[model samples]
Target: MTRQELRHKLQQVRRNLPAEQQLAAAFQVADKLEQRLESFVPQETTVAVYKSFAGELPTSPIIERLWQLGFKTVLPVLHPFAKGHLLFLSYTSKTPMTINKYGIEEPELNAQNVMPLSEVQVLLMPLVGFDHQGNRLGMGGGYYDRTLAQWHNGNRPNLSPIGLSYNEQQVESIPVESWDIPLPEIITPAKHWRF
Candidate 1:
């Protein structure tokens, strides 16, 4: 099937999922991802993560676990004045948060931008779907693609990009653009596939 066709089918699957089932599936996927992530001893101290939103794979539990394990966690902050640009915000339980234009919860702008993507040890990326080759299909905003491209051009950080998704979202292939970033690893409810 074509990329558009697969995207449509994935959307239909998403729409068919009831709220309870979605949450249940997300929890299962999260469990599997956390287990795999536990084995890696990160070279970079700080990690980047996204705050979960509608129909996306949830990461809050995993973030909390990482925090408990003494890892510094940062959440992505979308520039309030710009489109497709991102800033990293150090996150803690007390850090203030607000909804962005996309309606996703994010850290407050007041949070200091400590370091760039190069400083990040790991990035737990959220995706709508993924294929075995680690190609991620995002929500079409391309914020992640742009940010990753920038990082790749600069003193590229030793960061590992990992995609989280449910097994149902896996496909044989996904459309890739010139600027699209490929994930090195993808973790689903059933297993982890590394490229």
Candidate 2:
């Protein structure tokens, strides 16, 4: 099926999920991700993670676990004009937060901007849907695609990019744009798809 058709089918599946089942799926997916990530003891001091919202894959538990493991966790700060230029801010349970234009919670702007993407060891990317090849369909903001493109152009150090999603959101294929970023690993409740 085409990208739009696949997106439509995934939307139907999402709509059919009851609230309880949705939560269960999120928890299950998180468990799988946590297990895999746990094995790769992050060597880079700073890691980037996205905060979960709406139908996005959940990562709160993983974030908490990373914190306890002494890995410095950072989150994306959305830019007004840029589709995917994000400022990384240190994250803590008590860090002051504010909702951005997208209604996603983010760390306070005053937080210091540290090293760029090269300094980040791993990125736990969130997605609305993904395919076997690790092509991700986001919430249509294009922010992640843009940010990843910039990171690549800068020739930053190798940072593992992983997409998180529920099993129901997986598709056979997703249309790729010229600027779209491909993930190395795609993790879901049922299994992990590596590209």
Candidate 3:
């Protein structure tokens, strides 16, 4: 199937999940991630994550767990000046949030609150679909593809890009474009996938 068709199919599959199942999956993913956190990042390292939207896997539980575990967390904000790019901002329980053009909630932009890419150790990203080969199909905006292009090109050796999704989002194969970046790892309620 085509990329757009696959995205629609997987997105609907996830969106159809019961609320209780979504909650269980969120907590399950959080627990699995906590068990493997130390292997990727050191103590107190900054971990960048996205706020779940649409039928995406719920990340609130994971975010709360990270806060309780003392890991510094950051969230992606649409870059104000750079079109199609994302800026990571310091996210906490108290960070003021605003809706972006896409209607997704993000931490309010503040220059001082921006976390440089050099300071980000792990980036937990959301996706519409992912495959066993680690290829990720995003919401078609290419925000993450543009943001992590450098990392995929071996420029950001210190950065770890991980995708978060539900098991149902997995596809047999994804039609990849030249600029698509495959994630090194992805975590789901069922299993942790390492590519």
C-alpha RMSD by candidate, in order: 2.7, 2.6, 1.2
Error of 2 at 33 (Å): 2.7
Query: On a 0 to 100 scale, what is the lDDT of residue 70 in model 3?
Result: 84
Better candidate by TM-score, 1 or 2: 1
lDDT by residue (tens digit), candidate 3, 1-195: 899998888889999999999999999999988887867444558999889899788999999998888889999999999999999999999999999999899999999999988889888998899888999999999999987897977778998888888888888889999999999999998999999
RMSD of 1: 2.7
Q: Against the hidden reference, what TM-scores do the models get? A: 0.84, 0.84, 0.96
Q: Tell me how far the alpha carbon of residue 184 in candidate 1 is from the true structure, in angstroms, after superposition.
A: 0.8
Instruction: State which candidate, 1 or 2, has the greater lDDT.
Output: 1
Give the C-alpha miss distance for residue 92 in model 3, angstroms: 0.6
User: What clash pairs does model 2 have?
Assistant: 83-143, 84-143
lDDT of 1 at 85: 83
What digit string (tens of lDDT, one per residue) describes model 1 on residues 1-195?
766777778867766777777677666766675676675664337778888776666677677767766778888988766777888888889988888888999888873554567778777888888887888888788888877776566556577777877778888889887877778788776788898
Runs in model 3 with CA error above 4 Å?
40-43
Per-residue CA lDDT of model 2 for 37-70, tens digit only, reads 6756654467788888775656776787677767
**Residue 11 in candidate 3, Cα distance off native in Å:** 1.1
